[model samples]
Target: MLEGHQLLGFGFFVIGLWHLFNHTKLHALGSKSYTSTLWFPTTISRYMELHFIMASCTIFIAMELFIAPIHHQPFDPDGTIPTTHLHNFEHSSMAMSFLVYAIFAIVLDMKCTMAQHELTHFLGAIAFTQQFLLIHLHSRDHVGPEGQYHLLLQLLITVSLATTLMGIGFPKSFLVCFVRSVSIVFQGVWLMIMGFLLWTPGFQPKGCFMHLEETEEYVVKCSDDEALHRAVSLVNILFSFLVIGVTVFAMSFYLVMLRRYGGKVEYVSLVKEEHYREEDGFVKPKGTIDLENNMDDDESQKKSMQE
Candidate 1:
Protein backbone atom coordinates (compact mmCIF):
# COMPACT_ATOMS: atom_id res chain seq x y z
CA MET A 1 0.00 0.00 0.00
CA LEU A 2 2.87 2.38 0.77
CA GLU A 3 4.41 1.60 -2.60
CA GLY A 4 1.08 2.18 -4.28
CA HIS A 5 0.71 5.62 -2.71
CA GLN A 6 4.20 6.57 -3.75
CA LEU A 7 3.69 5.33 -7.30
CA LEU A 8 0.39 7.12 -7.68
CA GLY A 9 1.89 10.25 -6.22
CA PHE A 10 4.70 10.18 -8.76
CA GLY A 11 2.23 9.70 -11.60
CA PHE A 12 0.06 12.60 -10.49
CA PHE A 13 3.07 14.81 -10.04
CA VAL A 14 4.26 14.12 -13.58
CA ILE A 15 0.87 14.75 -15.13
CA GLY A 16 0.35 17.91 -13.12
CA LEU A 17 3.76 19.22 -14.07
CA TRP A 18 3.09 18.47 -17.71
CA HIS A 19 -0.15 20.42 -17.56
CA LEU A 20 1.42 23.29 -15.64
CA PHE A 21 4.01 23.80 -18.37
CA ASN A 22 1.58 23.43 -21.25
CA HIS A 23 -1.06 25.73 -19.83
CA THR A 24 1.50 28.36 -18.92
CA LYS A 25 2.99 28.14 -22.40
CA LEU A 26 -0.37 28.34 -24.04
CA HIS A 27 -1.38 31.43 -22.15
CA ALA A 28 2.02 32.99 -22.54
CA LEU A 29 2.03 32.49 -26.29
CA GLY A 30 -1.50 33.73 -26.94
CA SER A 31 -3.72 34.58 -24.03
CA LYS A 32 -6.22 36.28 -26.31
CA SER A 33 -6.76 33.08 -28.28
CA TYR A 34 -6.58 30.84 -25.22
CA THR A 35 -9.14 28.12 -24.77
CA SER A 36 -9.06 25.53 -22.02
CA THR A 37 -8.53 21.88 -22.82
CA LEU A 38 -9.08 18.91 -20.55
CA TRP A 39 -5.89 17.39 -21.86
CA PHE A 40 -2.98 18.61 -23.87
CA PRO A 41 -1.70 17.19 -27.16
CA THR A 42 1.79 15.75 -27.34
CA THR A 43 4.32 15.47 -30.16
CA ILE A 44 4.24 11.69 -29.93
CA SER A 45 0.43 11.43 -29.99
CA ARG A 46 -2.49 13.82 -29.74
CA TYR A 47 -4.16 11.60 -27.19
CA MET A 48 -1.09 10.89 -25.13
CA GLU A 49 -2.41 12.51 -21.94
CA LEU A 50 -5.78 10.85 -22.11
CA HIS A 51 -4.23 7.51 -22.97
CA PHE A 52 -1.96 7.85 -19.96
CA ILE A 53 -4.87 8.53 -17.63
CA MET A 54 -6.75 5.54 -18.98
CA ALA A 55 -3.80 3.19 -18.77
CA SER A 56 -2.78 4.28 -15.27
CA CYS A 57 -6.30 4.03 -13.93
CA THR A 58 -6.73 0.57 -15.44
CA ILE A 59 -3.52 -0.72 -13.86
CA PHE A 60 -4.30 0.90 -10.50
CA ILE A 61 -7.75 -0.63 -10.44
CA ALA A 62 -6.30 -4.03 -11.19
CA MET A 63 -3.74 -3.67 -8.45
CA GLU A 64 -6.28 -2.60 -5.88
CA LEU A 65 -8.83 -5.26 -6.76
CA PHE A 66 -6.79 -8.29 -7.69
CA ILE A 67 -3.14 -8.18 -6.76
CA ALA A 68 -3.09 -6.35 -3.45
CA PRO A 69 -5.60 -8.50 -1.61
CA ILE A 70 -4.33 -11.24 0.72
CA HIS A 71 -6.43 -13.92 -0.98
CA HIS A 72 -5.68 -12.53 -4.46
CA GLN A 73 -9.27 -11.35 -4.54
CA PRO A 74 -11.46 -8.95 -2.59
CA PHE A 75 -14.12 -11.48 -1.81
CA ASP A 76 -14.23 -14.16 0.87
CA PRO A 77 -14.41 -17.91 0.13
CA ASP A 78 -18.08 -17.84 1.11
CA GLY A 79 -18.75 -15.29 -1.68
CA THR A 80 -19.04 -12.31 0.67
CA ILE A 81 -16.93 -9.19 0.60
CA PRO A 82 -14.22 -8.99 3.22
CA THR A 83 -14.14 -5.92 5.46
CA THR A 84 -10.37 -5.78 5.18
CA HIS A 85 -10.62 -5.22 1.41
CA LEU A 86 -13.37 -2.60 1.45
CA HIS A 87 -10.88 0.26 1.08
CA ASN A 88 -9.38 -1.46 -1.95
CA PHE A 89 -12.78 -1.64 -3.62
CA GLU A 90 -13.36 2.02 -2.83
CA HIS A 91 -10.04 2.93 -4.41
CA SER A 92 -10.79 0.83 -7.50
CA SER A 93 -14.08 2.63 -7.89
CA MET A 94 -12.29 5.98 -7.87
CA ALA A 95 -9.88 4.76 -10.55
CA MET A 96 -12.83 3.51 -12.63
CA SER A 97 -14.29 7.03 -12.63
CA PHE A 98 -11.10 8.48 -14.05
CA LEU A 99 -10.96 5.69 -16.64
CA VAL A 100 -14.45 6.58 -17.75
CA TYR A 101 -13.48 10.24 -18.00
CA ALA A 102 -10.41 9.51 -20.13
CA ILE A 103 -12.32 7.24 -22.52
CA PHE A 104 -15.08 9.77 -23.09
CA ALA A 105 -12.69 12.68 -23.42
CA ILE A 106 -10.96 10.91 -26.30
CA VAL A 107 -14.26 10.16 -28.01
CA LEU A 108 -15.44 13.75 -27.71
CA ASP A 109 -12.14 15.14 -28.95
CA MET A 110 -12.17 12.91 -32.01
CA LYS A 111 -15.77 13.71 -32.87
CA CYS A 112 -15.06 17.45 -32.93
CA THR A 113 -18.52 18.45 -31.89
CA MET A 114 -19.27 22.06 -30.97
CA ALA A 115 -19.66 21.11 -27.32
CA GLN A 116 -16.67 18.82 -27.22
CA HIS A 117 -14.54 20.98 -24.96
CA GLU A 118 -17.38 21.61 -22.55
CA LEU A 119 -18.18 17.92 -22.38
CA THR A 120 -14.57 17.08 -21.76
CA HIS A 121 -14.41 19.60 -18.94
CA PHE A 122 -17.57 18.19 -17.48
CA LEU A 123 -16.09 14.71 -17.47
CA GLY A 124 -12.97 15.98 -15.80
CA ALA A 125 -15.08 17.68 -13.17
CA ILE A 126 -16.90 14.42 -12.54
CA ALA A 127 -13.64 12.59 -12.03
CA PHE A 128 -12.47 15.13 -9.48
CA THR A 129 -15.81 14.96 -7.73
CA GLN A 130 -15.52 11.20 -7.46
CA GLN A 131 -12.04 11.49 -6.04
CA PHE A 132 -13.14 14.08 -3.50
CA LEU A 133 -16.05 11.96 -2.35
CA LEU A 134 -13.99 8.81 -2.01
CA ILE A 135 -11.27 10.44 0.00
CA HIS A 136 -13.72 12.33 2.18
CA LEU A 137 -15.58 9.14 3.01
CA HIS A 138 -12.65 6.78 3.04
CA SER A 139 -13.36 3.33 4.46
CA ARG A 140 -10.39 3.45 6.80
CA ASP A 141 -10.32 5.60 9.87
CA HIS A 142 -8.19 8.72 9.51
CA VAL A 143 -7.28 10.10 12.93
CA GLY A 144 -4.43 11.83 14.75
CA PRO A 145 -1.75 13.28 12.49
CA GLU A 146 -2.94 11.18 9.57
CA GLY A 147 -6.39 12.71 9.92
CA GLN A 148 -4.89 16.19 9.83
CA TYR A 149 -3.05 15.32 6.62
CA HIS A 150 -6.19 13.99 4.98
CA LEU A 151 -8.20 16.96 6.15
CA LEU A 152 -5.74 19.28 4.45
CA LEU A 153 -5.77 17.02 1.43
CA GLN A 154 -9.53 17.39 1.14
CA LEU A 155 -9.14 21.17 0.87
CA LEU A 156 -6.80 20.77 -2.08
CA ILE A 157 -9.18 18.30 -3.74
CA THR A 158 -11.99 20.75 -3.26
CA VAL A 159 -9.97 23.43 -5.02
CA SER A 160 -9.39 21.03 -7.91
CA LEU A 161 -13.07 20.15 -8.10
CA ALA A 162 -14.22 23.76 -7.94
CA THR A 163 -11.77 24.90 -10.57
CA THR A 164 -12.66 22.05 -12.92
CA LEU A 165 -16.28 23.10 -12.74
CA MET A 166 -15.29 26.70 -13.29
CA GLY A 167 -13.29 25.66 -16.35
CA ILE A 168 -16.47 24.53 -18.06
CA GLY A 169 -17.89 28.01 -17.84
CA PHE A 170 -14.73 30.09 -18.09
CA PRO A 171 -12.67 28.08 -20.47
CA LYS A 172 -10.48 31.03 -21.26
CA SER A 173 -9.58 31.80 -17.67
CA PHE A 174 -5.92 31.00 -17.20
CA LEU A 175 -6.25 31.59 -13.46
CA VAL A 176 -8.77 28.77 -13.13
CA CYS A 177 -6.58 26.29 -15.00
CA PHE A 178 -3.51 27.38 -13.10
CA VAL A 179 -5.13 26.86 -9.73
CA ARG A 180 -6.48 23.47 -10.78
CA SER A 181 -3.09 22.26 -11.91
CA VAL A 182 -1.42 23.51 -8.76
CA SER A 183 -3.97 21.73 -6.61
CA ILE A 184 -3.29 18.44 -8.36
CA VAL A 185 0.44 18.83 -7.92
CA PHE A 186 -0.07 19.64 -4.25
CA GLN A 187 -2.28 16.58 -3.79
CA GLY A 188 0.42 14.33 -5.21
CA VAL A 189 3.07 15.88 -2.99
CA TRP A 190 0.87 15.52 0.08
CA LEU A 191 0.08 11.90 -0.70
CA MET A 192 3.75 11.04 -0.93
CA ILE A 193 4.38 12.87 2.33
CA MET A 194 1.60 10.93 4.01
CA GLY A 195 2.98 7.63 2.78
CA PHE A 196 6.38 8.47 4.20
CA LEU A 197 5.29 9.97 7.51
CA LEU A 198 2.55 7.48 8.28
CA TRP A 199 4.13 4.28 7.06
CA THR A 200 7.84 4.85 7.64
CA PRO A 201 8.94 4.44 11.25
CA GLY A 202 11.92 6.69 10.77
CA PHE A 203 9.78 9.65 9.75
CA GLN A 204 7.05 9.27 12.33
CA PRO A 205 6.25 12.29 14.48
CA LYS A 206 8.44 12.97 17.51
CA GLY A 207 6.01 11.51 20.03
CA CYS A 208 4.25 9.04 17.73
CA PHE A 209 5.18 5.43 16.94
CA MET A 210 3.97 3.00 14.29
CA HIS A 211 1.69 0.23 15.51
CA LEU A 212 1.03 -2.83 13.40
CA GLU A 213 -2.58 -3.90 13.33
CA GLU A 214 -4.21 -7.25 12.55
CA THR A 215 -5.01 -6.04 9.03
CA GLU A 216 -1.27 -5.66 8.39
CA GLU A 217 -1.55 -1.89 8.29
CA TYR A 218 0.69 0.34 10.36
CA VAL A 219 -1.08 3.02 12.37
CA VAL A 220 0.45 6.02 14.07
CA LYS A 221 -0.09 6.09 17.81
CA CYS A 222 1.04 8.78 20.24
CA SER A 223 2.48 8.24 23.69
CA ASP A 224 -0.16 10.41 25.28
CA ASP A 225 -2.83 13.06 24.56
CA GLU A 226 -0.24 15.82 24.65
CA ALA A 227 1.84 13.96 22.07
CA LEU A 228 -1.16 13.44 19.79
CA HIS A 229 -1.97 17.14 19.94
CA ARG A 230 1.62 18.00 19.18
CA ALA A 231 1.67 15.57 16.23
CA VAL A 232 -1.47 17.03 14.77
CA SER A 233 -0.11 20.55 15.16
CA LEU A 234 3.07 19.50 13.43
CA VAL A 235 1.07 18.17 10.50
CA ASN A 236 -0.67 21.54 10.16
CA ILE A 237 2.65 23.33 10.18
CA LEU A 238 3.95 21.01 7.48
CA PHE A 239 0.88 21.71 5.36
CA SER A 240 1.47 25.46 5.66
CA PHE A 241 5.07 25.07 4.59
CA LEU A 242 4.03 22.92 1.64
CA VAL A 243 1.57 25.55 0.51
CA ILE A 244 4.24 28.22 0.62
CA GLY A 245 6.77 26.09 -1.22
CA VAL A 246 4.33 25.10 -3.96
CA THR A 247 3.19 28.68 -4.44
CA VAL A 248 6.76 29.91 -4.84
CA PHE A 249 7.57 27.13 -7.29
CA ALA A 250 4.45 27.84 -9.35
CA MET A 251 5.08 31.56 -9.55
CA SER A 252 8.74 31.07 -10.44
CA PHE A 253 7.80 28.65 -13.21
CA TYR A 254 5.23 31.09 -14.59
CA LEU A 255 7.70 33.98 -14.56
CA VAL A 256 10.29 31.92 -16.43
CA MET A 257 7.86 30.76 -19.09
CA LEU A 258 6.34 34.21 -19.42
CA ARG A 259 9.79 35.65 -20.07
CA ARG A 260 10.54 32.94 -22.62
CA TYR A 261 7.24 33.01 -24.57
CA GLY A 262 4.90 35.77 -23.45
CA GLY A 263 7.09 38.61 -24.66
CA LYS A 264 7.57 37.26 -28.18
CA VAL A 265 7.61 39.74 -31.05
CA GLU A 266 4.86 37.89 -32.87
CA TYR A 267 2.31 38.49 -30.14
CA VAL A 268 3.61 42.02 -29.59
CA SER A 269 3.31 42.76 -33.29
CA LEU A 270 -0.26 41.54 -33.33
CA VAL A 271 -1.11 43.94 -30.54
CA LYS A 272 0.70 46.75 -32.34
CA GLU A 273 -1.23 46.06 -35.54
CA GLU A 274 -4.53 46.17 -33.66
CA HIS A 275 -3.58 49.43 -31.95
CA TYR A 276 -2.58 51.06 -35.25
CA ARG A 277 -5.79 49.99 -36.95
CA GLU A 278 -7.91 51.30 -34.09
CA GLU A 279 -6.13 54.70 -33.97
CA ASP A 280 -5.48 55.30 -37.68
CA GLY A 281 -8.49 53.51 -39.22
CA PHE A 282 -6.07 51.25 -41.18
CA VAL A 283 -3.08 49.06 -40.46
CA LYS A 284 0.22 50.89 -40.99
CA PRO A 285 2.39 48.83 -43.26
CA LYS A 286 6.03 48.20 -42.43
CA GLY A 287 8.54 50.62 -44.08
CA THR A 288 5.72 52.88 -45.27
CA ILE A 289 6.63 55.81 -47.59
CA ASP A 290 7.23 59.12 -45.76
CA LEU A 291 4.55 61.61 -46.78
CA GLU A 292 6.57 64.55 -45.35
CA ASN A 293 9.60 63.64 -47.48
CA ASN A 294 7.38 63.36 -50.58
CA MET A 295 5.88 66.77 -49.90
CA ASP A 296 9.32 68.37 -49.48
CA ASP A 297 10.58 66.86 -52.77
CA ASP A 298 7.49 68.08 -54.64
CA GLU A 299 8.04 71.62 -53.24
CA SER A 300 11.66 71.59 -54.39
CA GLN A 301 10.62 70.53 -57.88
CA LYS A 302 7.98 73.31 -57.99
CA LYS A 303 10.60 75.96 -56.90
CA SER A 304 13.04 74.73 -59.54
CA MET A 305 10.31 74.86 -62.21
CA GLN A 306 9.44 78.43 -61.11
CA GLU A 307 13.11 79.50 -61.27
Candidate 2:
Protein backbone atom coordinates (compact mmCIF):
# COMPACT_ATOMS: atom_id res chain seq x y z
CA MET A 1 0.00 0.00 0.00
CA LEU A 2 1.56 3.24 -1.15
CA GLU A 3 1.33 6.50 0.83
CA GLY A 4 -0.58 9.62 -0.23
CA HIS A 5 2.34 11.12 -2.09
CA GLN A 6 3.00 7.86 -3.88
CA LEU A 7 -0.66 7.63 -4.89
CA LEU A 8 -0.60 11.18 -6.24
CA GLY A 9 2.58 10.50 -8.18
CA PHE A 10 1.07 7.39 -9.68
CA GLY A 11 -1.96 9.37 -10.85
CA PHE A 12 0.31 11.90 -12.52
CA PHE A 13 2.22 9.13 -14.24
CA VAL A 14 -1.02 7.77 -15.67
CA ILE A 15 -2.13 11.14 -17.04
CA GLY A 16 1.30 11.96 -18.44
CA LEU A 17 1.41 8.71 -20.37
CA TRP A 18 -2.18 8.78 -21.58
CA HIS A 19 -1.96 11.72 -23.98
CA LEU A 20 1.52 11.03 -25.31
CA PHE A 21 0.77 7.42 -26.20
CA ASN A 22 -2.48 8.37 -27.91
CA HIS A 23 -0.96 11.23 -29.91
CA THR A 24 0.71 9.31 -32.73
CA LYS A 25 -2.19 7.29 -34.11
CA LEU A 26 -4.56 10.19 -34.75
CA HIS A 27 -3.51 10.50 -38.41
CA ALA A 28 -4.39 6.94 -39.45
CA LEU A 29 -7.87 6.75 -37.96
CA GLY A 30 -10.04 7.94 -40.83
CA SER A 31 -8.32 5.93 -43.56
CA LYS A 32 -8.65 2.48 -42.08
CA SER A 33 -10.91 0.32 -39.93
CA TYR A 34 -12.78 2.19 -37.19
CA THR A 35 -11.49 0.76 -33.94
CA SER A 36 -10.71 2.08 -30.46
CA THR A 37 -7.04 2.00 -31.43
CA LEU A 38 -7.42 4.79 -34.02
CA TRP A 39 -7.30 8.56 -33.57
CA PHE A 40 -7.65 11.15 -36.34
CA PRO A 41 -5.20 14.06 -36.43
CA THR A 42 -6.59 17.48 -37.11
CA THR A 43 -5.34 20.61 -35.30
CA ILE A 44 -7.37 19.55 -32.32
CA SER A 45 -6.41 15.91 -32.36
CA ARG A 46 -2.70 16.64 -32.60
CA TYR A 47 -2.71 18.96 -29.58
CA MET A 48 -2.91 16.16 -27.05
CA GLU A 49 0.81 15.73 -27.49
CA LEU A 50 1.43 19.30 -26.38
CA HIS A 51 -1.03 18.98 -23.53
CA PHE A 52 0.86 15.97 -22.23
CA ILE A 53 4.14 17.80 -22.54
CA MET A 54 2.90 20.59 -20.31
CA ALA A 55 1.26 18.29 -17.78
CA SER A 56 4.43 16.28 -17.35
CA CYS A 57 5.74 19.07 -15.17
CA THR A 58 2.84 18.72 -12.83
CA ILE A 59 3.88 15.13 -12.20
CA PHE A 60 7.48 16.16 -11.73
CA ILE A 61 6.54 18.67 -9.05
CA ALA A 62 4.28 16.19 -7.36
CA MET A 63 7.11 13.70 -7.09
CA GLU A 64 9.69 16.24 -6.03
CA LEU A 65 7.59 17.72 -3.27
CA PHE A 66 5.44 14.86 -2.13
CA ILE A 67 7.41 11.72 -2.84
CA ALA A 68 11.10 11.03 -2.23
CA PRO A 69 13.33 13.95 -1.35
CA ILE A 70 17.00 14.32 -2.33
CA HIS A 71 17.57 12.59 1.02
CA HIS A 72 14.50 10.41 1.41
CA GLN A 73 11.17 11.88 2.64
CA PRO A 74 11.46 15.58 3.48
CA PHE A 75 8.67 16.65 5.77
CA ASP A 76 8.28 20.36 5.14
CA PRO A 77 4.80 21.35 3.97
CA ASP A 78 3.82 21.55 7.63
CA GLY A 79 7.02 23.44 8.39
CA THR A 80 6.55 26.27 5.89
CA ILE A 81 5.75 29.10 8.21
CA PRO A 82 4.04 32.46 7.75
CA THR A 83 0.68 31.19 6.69
CA THR A 84 -0.41 34.75 5.95
CA HIS A 85 1.57 34.57 2.73
CA LEU A 86 -1.04 34.25 -0.01
CA HIS A 87 1.66 33.52 -2.54
CA ASN A 88 1.86 30.05 -1.07
CA PHE A 89 -1.56 29.04 -2.31
CA GLU A 90 -1.08 30.85 -5.60
CA HIS A 91 2.14 29.01 -6.44
CA SER A 92 1.00 25.64 -5.16
CA SER A 93 -2.19 25.70 -7.16
CA MET A 94 -0.53 26.66 -10.44
CA ALA A 95 0.30 23.10 -11.48
CA MET A 96 -3.21 21.87 -10.63
CA SER A 97 -4.76 24.70 -12.64
CA PHE A 98 -2.60 23.74 -15.59
CA LEU A 99 -3.82 20.19 -15.21
CA VAL A 100 -7.41 21.40 -15.40
CA TYR A 101 -6.74 23.27 -18.62
CA ALA A 102 -4.96 20.30 -20.16
CA ILE A 103 -7.98 18.11 -19.50
CA PHE A 104 -10.43 20.70 -20.81
CA ALA A 105 -8.28 21.32 -23.86
CA ILE A 106 -8.32 17.63 -24.68
CA VAL A 107 -12.13 17.61 -24.70
CA LEU A 108 -12.26 20.81 -26.73
CA ASP A 109 -9.89 19.33 -29.29
CA MET A 110 -12.15 16.34 -29.57
CA LYS A 111 -15.09 18.59 -30.38
CA CYS A 112 -13.12 20.67 -32.85
CA THR A 113 -11.96 17.54 -34.67
CA MET A 114 -15.59 16.48 -34.99
CA ALA A 115 -16.18 19.81 -36.82
CA GLN A 116 -18.16 21.30 -33.97
CA HIS A 117 -16.33 24.58 -34.25
CA GLU A 118 -18.69 26.81 -32.34
CA LEU A 119 -18.97 24.68 -29.22
CA THR A 120 -15.32 23.68 -29.27
CA HIS A 121 -14.17 27.27 -29.54
CA PHE A 122 -16.61 28.29 -26.86
CA LEU A 123 -15.20 25.72 -24.44
CA GLY A 124 -11.72 26.99 -25.17
CA ALA A 125 -12.75 30.51 -24.22
CA ILE A 126 -14.38 29.32 -21.04
CA ALA A 127 -11.20 27.54 -19.96
CA PHE A 128 -9.20 30.68 -20.59
CA THR A 129 -11.74 32.70 -18.68
CA GLN A 130 -11.39 30.36 -15.73
CA GLN A 131 -7.62 30.82 -15.57
CA PHE A 132 -7.85 34.58 -16.05
CA LEU A 133 -10.29 34.89 -13.21
CA LEU A 134 -8.17 32.67 -11.00
CA ILE A 135 -5.11 34.82 -11.57
CA HIS A 136 -7.14 37.96 -11.01
CA LEU A 137 -8.63 36.67 -7.79
CA HIS A 138 -5.36 35.40 -6.41
CA SER A 139 -3.53 38.52 -7.44
CA ARG A 140 -6.16 40.74 -5.95
CA ASP A 141 -6.03 38.88 -2.66
CA HIS A 142 -2.24 38.87 -2.57
CA VAL A 143 -2.04 42.51 -1.57
CA GLY A 144 -4.10 41.91 1.56
CA PRO A 145 -6.86 44.49 2.14
CA GLU A 146 -5.12 47.16 0.02
CA GLY A 147 -3.90 47.50 -3.53
CA GLN A 148 -0.94 49.89 -3.29
CA TYR A 149 2.06 47.65 -3.94
CA HIS A 150 4.14 46.98 -7.04
CA LEU A 151 3.17 43.30 -7.26
CA LEU A 152 -0.40 44.47 -6.94
CA LEU A 153 0.16 46.80 -9.84
CA GLN A 154 1.65 43.99 -11.89
CA LEU A 155 -1.34 41.81 -11.11
CA LEU A 156 -3.69 44.54 -12.25
CA ILE A 157 -1.73 44.95 -15.43
CA THR A 158 -2.10 41.28 -16.21
CA VAL A 159 -5.81 41.49 -15.45
CA SER A 160 -6.12 44.47 -17.74
CA LEU A 161 -4.49 42.51 -20.53
CA ALA A 162 -6.95 39.71 -19.98
CA THR A 163 -9.77 42.21 -20.02
CA THR A 164 -8.48 43.66 -23.24
CA LEU A 165 -8.30 40.20 -24.67
CA MET A 166 -11.99 39.63 -23.92
CA GLY A 167 -12.96 43.08 -25.19
CA ILE A 168 -11.16 42.90 -28.53
CA GLY A 169 -12.13 39.34 -29.50
CA PHE A 170 -8.73 37.79 -29.94
CA PRO A 171 -8.52 34.33 -31.48
CA LYS A 172 -8.43 31.41 -29.03
CA SER A 173 -4.88 30.43 -29.88
CA PHE A 174 -3.73 34.02 -29.49
CA LEU A 175 -5.34 34.21 -26.10
CA VAL A 176 -3.58 31.00 -25.10
CA CYS A 177 -0.30 32.49 -26.23
CA PHE A 178 -0.87 35.61 -24.18
CA VAL A 179 -1.66 33.64 -21.07
CA ARG A 180 1.33 31.39 -21.53
CA SER A 181 3.63 34.38 -21.92
CA VAL A 182 2.39 36.16 -18.83
CA SER A 183 2.49 33.03 -16.72
CA ILE A 184 6.08 32.30 -17.67
CA VAL A 185 7.24 35.81 -16.80
CA PHE A 186 5.35 35.67 -13.55
CA GLN A 187 6.97 32.31 -12.72
CA GLY A 188 10.44 33.69 -13.27
CA VAL A 189 9.61 36.64 -11.05
CA TRP A 190 8.37 34.30 -8.34
CA LEU A 191 11.46 32.11 -8.58
CA MET A 192 13.71 35.12 -8.14
CA ILE A 193 11.73 36.13 -5.09
CA MET A 194 12.08 32.66 -3.60
CA GLY A 195 15.80 32.54 -4.25
CA PHE A 196 16.28 35.96 -2.70
CA LEU A 197 14.37 34.98 0.40
CA LEU A 198 16.08 31.62 0.76
CA TRP A 199 19.60 32.99 0.48
CA THR A 200 18.88 36.13 2.48
CA PRO A 201 21.02 34.81 5.45
CA GLY A 202 18.06 35.61 7.69
CA PHE A 203 15.21 33.52 6.18
CA GLN A 204 16.11 30.56 8.40
CA PRO A 205 17.14 31.31 11.96
CA LYS A 206 20.44 29.93 13.30
CA GLY A 207 19.28 29.78 16.94
CA CYS A 208 16.02 28.10 15.99
CA PHE A 209 17.96 25.36 14.22
CA MET A 210 15.29 22.72 14.63
CA HIS A 211 12.24 24.97 15.12
CA LEU A 212 12.20 23.51 18.67
CA GLU A 213 10.20 26.15 20.55
CA GLU A 214 7.57 26.94 17.90
CA THR A 215 5.08 24.26 18.84
CA GLU A 216 5.06 21.32 21.23
CA GLU A 217 3.13 19.34 18.62
CA TYR A 218 5.97 19.88 16.16
CA VAL A 219 8.15 16.88 15.66
CA VAL A 220 11.92 17.44 15.43
CA LYS A 221 13.33 18.11 11.98
CA CYS A 222 14.57 14.95 10.38
CA SER A 223 18.32 14.32 10.73
CA ASP A 224 18.66 14.95 7.01
CA ASP A 225 17.22 18.47 7.14
CA GLU A 226 20.19 19.80 5.16
CA ALA A 227 19.51 17.23 2.48
CA LEU A 228 15.85 18.29 2.54
CA HIS A 229 16.87 21.90 1.91
CA ARG A 230 19.00 20.83 -1.03
CA ALA A 231 16.10 18.80 -2.45
CA VAL A 232 13.74 21.71 -2.14
CA SER A 233 16.23 24.05 -3.75
CA LEU A 234 16.91 21.64 -6.60
CA VAL A 235 13.21 21.20 -7.30
CA ASN A 236 12.68 24.93 -7.22
CA ILE A 237 15.42 25.49 -9.78
CA LEU A 238 14.13 22.73 -12.03
CA PHE A 239 10.61 24.17 -11.84
CA SER A 240 11.85 27.54 -13.06
CA PHE A 241 13.55 25.89 -16.00
CA LEU A 242 10.45 23.84 -16.72
CA VAL A 243 8.29 26.93 -16.80
CA ILE A 244 10.68 28.61 -19.18
CA GLY A 245 10.81 25.53 -21.37
CA VAL A 246 7.02 25.30 -21.51
CA THR A 247 6.65 28.95 -22.48
CA VAL A 248 9.09 28.60 -25.35
CA PHE A 249 7.54 25.34 -26.49
CA ALA A 250 4.05 26.81 -26.44
CA MET A 251 5.06 29.87 -28.41
CA SER A 252 7.02 27.90 -31.00
CA PHE A 253 4.35 25.26 -31.48
CA TYR A 254 1.63 27.87 -31.77
CA LEU A 255 3.59 29.63 -34.48
CA VAL A 256 4.21 26.37 -36.32
CA MET A 257 0.55 25.40 -36.23
CA LEU A 258 -0.42 28.85 -37.45
CA ARG A 259 1.93 28.46 -40.39
CA ARG A 260 0.67 25.01 -41.28
CA TYR A 261 -2.95 26.09 -41.06
CA GLY A 262 -2.35 29.20 -43.17
CA GLY A 263 -1.14 27.10 -46.10
CA LYS A 264 -3.70 26.18 -48.77
CA VAL A 265 -4.83 22.56 -48.99
CA GLU A 266 -7.32 20.46 -50.95
CA TYR A 267 -10.92 21.37 -50.21
CA VAL A 268 -13.39 18.70 -49.27
CA SER A 269 -16.89 19.98 -48.50
CA LEU A 270 -17.92 18.75 -45.04
CA VAL A 271 -21.41 20.25 -45.08
CA LYS A 272 -24.39 17.98 -44.80
CA GLU A 273 -26.04 16.79 -48.02
CA GLU A 274 -29.56 17.94 -48.86
CA HIS A 275 -31.28 14.71 -49.78
CA TYR A 276 -34.66 16.47 -49.67
CA ARG A 277 -33.96 18.47 -52.85
CA GLU A 278 -35.14 16.43 -55.83
CA GLU A 279 -32.33 15.98 -58.37
CA ASP A 280 -34.38 16.62 -61.53
CA GLY A 281 -31.43 17.04 -63.92
CA PHE A 282 -28.09 17.49 -62.32
CA VAL A 283 -25.02 15.53 -63.44
CA LYS A 284 -22.03 15.66 -61.16
CA PRO A 285 -18.61 15.55 -62.85
CA LYS A 286 -17.51 12.04 -63.72
CA GLY A 287 -14.71 10.66 -61.61
CA THR A 288 -11.24 10.00 -63.06
CA ILE A 289 -11.94 6.26 -63.60
CA ASP A 290 -14.87 7.08 -65.93
CA LEU A 291 -13.13 9.95 -67.87
CA GLU A 292 -10.61 7.80 -69.80
CA ASN A 293 -10.62 8.14 -73.69
CA ASN A 294 -8.68 4.82 -74.04
CA MET A 295 -11.84 2.59 -74.08
CA ASP A 296 -12.78 3.54 -77.65
CA ASP A 297 -9.24 2.91 -78.98
CA ASP A 298 -9.16 -0.50 -77.28
CA GLU A 299 -12.45 -1.54 -78.98
CA SER A 300 -11.23 -0.32 -82.42
CA GLN A 301 -8.02 -2.29 -82.02
CA LYS A 302 -10.02 -5.41 -81.11
CA LYS A 303 -12.07 -5.14 -84.33
CA SER A 304 -8.94 -4.72 -86.45
CA MET A 305 -7.40 -7.80 -84.86
CA GLN A 306 -10.60 -9.80 -85.66
CA GLU A 307 -10.44 -8.70 -89.36
Best by TM-score: 1
| Steric collisions counted per model | 0, 2
- lDDT digits (tens) for residues 201-304 of candidate 2: 44432221223234321111223656555534554564567557755754574455445444445754433232222245445556735334578878889999
lDDT of 1 by residue, 1-307 (tens): 7766776677678788888999999999999998877689899999999899888888888888888887778898898888788888888887888899999988887788899878888888888889888888998898999888889988998998899899988999999999999888998899888888888767888889988779876678889999999999999999999999999999999999999998656445766876777788785579988687899999999999999
Backbone clash total for model 2 is 2
- Model 2 spans > 4 angstroms off: 1-45, 52-57, 60-65, 68-92, 113-157, 160-168, 172-183, 186-307
Q: Which regions of candidate 1 fall more than 4 Å away from where they truly are?
A: 264-307
Error of 2 at 265 (Å): 26
Worst 10 residues of 1 by lDDT: 263-272
